[model samples]
Target: MKIGELANRSGLTPSRIRFYERIGLLKAVDRKANGYRSYPAEAVTILGLIALAQGAGFSLDEIRALLPADLEHWEHDALAGALTRKVADIETLQARLARSKAHLLHVIDEIEARPDDIDCATNARRVLTRLLGEDAEMPVASLRAKQF
Candidate 1:
């Protein structure tokens, strides 16, 4: 099929497909006598795999290294190792995100726990102190005057 038909079948824009070709992610396509790009039926499957890898956070360079021009020649051990490493990276990111979420919730709890009798400025100062620690170099008085 031609580039347009390939793009339509693959659910990617023609320019994107051309960009992939330029970046060496997609192998060189055959050209017809009329100078139109010719793509094999397997191109659609390859494009789908590329999209899946990108959605899973693999960079184009990584995908290029992981995927061979011909799927039949894929190295099973290398592919498995790369997938395992990606899973570990994702797990580490999840842990960091969890910590960030917990810290945000702690900050919210501290800010919301202010006594009703305390003024906003004093409450802000108290929250800032708890957040920054008592020995923080930044002045709490100035921070309290600024809106959150």
Candidate 2:
């Protein structure tokens, strides 16, 4: 099938399909004598795999590693490795989210318990700045140094 047919069948743009080929995700397609790219019937299945990988949050580089030379005989190891890495990333993100939530709770508490006074306002502003990482920035338990 021509690239146009593949695009219609796979719902992928010609540029994207070509890019996948260039990036070693898709097989290099055969070209007609006129230099038009011709894909085999199996291209649809390969493209489908690429789409599935994207939906699973695998980067192109990761997907390229995960795709097997023979789809029908894919190894479990590749899939396991990819999933393990994704799990690690998710764990890191979860940790960050916990920290952010903790900071938000602290800010709410401060706002609720703060005394309305000139000295208190200055101290509160200083604390916020510290959490956000001011002058010489470094990660601190407080979110004051963070820029929202």
lDDT of 2 by residue, 28-129 (tens): 489889999999888999999899878967899888888887667677987898799898988988898998899789877866665666477676775666
Q: lDDT for model 1, please.
A: 0.86
Per-model C-alpha lDDT, please? 0.86, 0.81
Best by lDDT: 1
Q: Per-residue lDDT of 1-148 in model 1, one digit per residue for the tens?
A: 8899998899999999999988988884897888889888888988999999999988988899998769789989989999999999999989978987997898889989999999989998898777777444566687555433
How do the predictions measure up, each by TM-score? 0.86, 0.69
- Candidate 1's C-alpha runs over 4 A off are 138-148
Worst 10 residues of 2 by lDDT: 135-144
